[model samples]
Target: MTGPARSHTEAVAAVGRALAAYETQAGVAADAALVAARRIATDAAAAQADRQRHLERAEADLRACRAEPEARCTAEQARVVQEQHGLEVARRAVSMAERAVRDLAASRVRFRSEAAALITPGRTMTSVKGAELEAYLSSVGLRAVASAGPGSSSAGPVSAQRPSGGGGRDIGGLPEGFELVALDLVDVPDPVTGRDQFGKGYSPEDMAWAFSAFDDVVLPALRAGEGSEYFASLDAAEGRMGTRSYSDTYSGFLGSDAIVLEARPGGRYELSENGRHRFWVAQQTGRPTVPALVRR
Candidate 1:
């Protein structure tokens, strides 16, 4: 009975030891598999992070390339705008110059027309004789008849007398005793036939033409109160008055300033160049006693 019991116990102990050893080996294998799995996971995560960095770098390089072109485009646009502004300014200046030229040309044409119309042959007077002087006086609305002095007729030396109570000032460098006289009382000396007192190089035809132009054109302008304006327009167009001597005389007379005259050898007084235009205007418009500064 002792031997059988002893043998059973020994077999049972041996079986238990073998089973414990097998369990220990299985636990070590499971720990090694878990470590390997953790390493693989860490490596995969690191690779993914490196790929993301590469993508971000590529995007930054693309943005830099695009910015260079954009900057160049902005500079080019600014330059174009400045050039366009300069071109516009030049164009405007050219336009103004052209307009000024056109205005000057138009003014010259108008002046020429006015000068041409001034001296018509029919209205001009060549001499002062008989009723012609009286008719002219009447036409100018002068009631006073001219007094016959030492040389009353046209053939003899003419003297002009100042009317009583007709007060006047010395004008145009004439003598002090001279008084204002009607346009008809004073005779216009013919440039062709008589002595040219004013040194004007004009023929009788020219004188007559000038009178006609003044009467037809200048008188209406003066009566309408456009005298100053007309002169200004002419100046602006023709540059200035008095540049031409004859033109200056014309302007002076049209201005209605004092007319100067001198007594001739005969009873007739000679017309001064300064007063020619004024005298003509008075005659045409029937104005009496134009301001006259007479010289002996």
Candidate 2:
């Protein structure tokens, strides 16, 4: 074969090899996602059971406290109230876990389907360009694959400037090579409270108010099949609380936003200001890695 023809054939062979490798990696990711989904479902079931037991115990304790003379029962009553608060938090966690299990399961199926479509004969190269594969992986709730070569698009590093006016510190307990980190790590100066704040920390009163609003307004609106107004009300409440709305965060996780991370001296990572509930959700779901924009 002539030199140019030989080069062309070699290039084609290289593309084929790369595609094969991507197919294998995608298959592995899909299998792992399914396994993770099953594990999450099992864990969520156990958590729900545990929460139920705790709630029963708390109820029993409260009843016992109430039976005591009013003067003697004051401290006991306070303790029981704390227990009830804990039970409520646990219940919320259980709900989150159950939702994660469902989302992960659905994502596993979608990942498998998309991967299959990508690798099937004659469909492989269609619209395969910058960040499409990474975007698809993210859409299916899998970690973005690192680029294999120059031409392939990947989640590259972020800019070097440190975010302003926060208690910037590295967070521990992340799995090795974890790509996503919590936005709560970025301590922004709170305008209202005049303290360094990351995410909104809810007090008992805050929790009470949120739950009351949810039950009275949001829940009824949702049940009545009011869509936009329900969401708008929710957004207003979340804004007042200074927290990202759960639905917004949920959609953000499935989208293609780059998670910016800073590498510390001891190989730790600090999530940037842009990260929020997605990192927290990743931790809740026990995800091993996520797509990130590392700061060099």
| CA displacement after TM-score superposition, residue 291 of candidate 2 (Å) | 43
In order of appearance, the predictions have TM-scores of: 0.31, 0.34
Worst window of 10 by summed lDDT in candidate 1: 150-159
- The residue-by-residue lDDT of candidate 2 on 1-296, one tens digit each, is 33443344334445644655675588678678767767866776677677667667767777787776753666556766776777677677767777877776666555644553445331223213323544444455653334333122331111111222332322122223333333444322222231233346643333334333332233223322344443444454334323234333222332244356675564455666444443444344443334445564
Q: Model 1 residue 16 lDDT?
A: 31
Q: Any runs in candidate 1 off by more than 4 Å, and if so which?
A: 1-202, 235-296
Clashing pairs in 2: none
Q: Candidate 2, overall lDDT?
A: 0.44
lDDT of 1 by residue, 1-296 (tens): 13443333333333333332343344345445545545544554554455445445555555555578544454444544555555555455555545555554464445443442332111112111322443444455643233322112111101122333322323221234444555555777542233343245544445444444444344333322344555455554556544233344345443344466776664456677565644554454455455455667
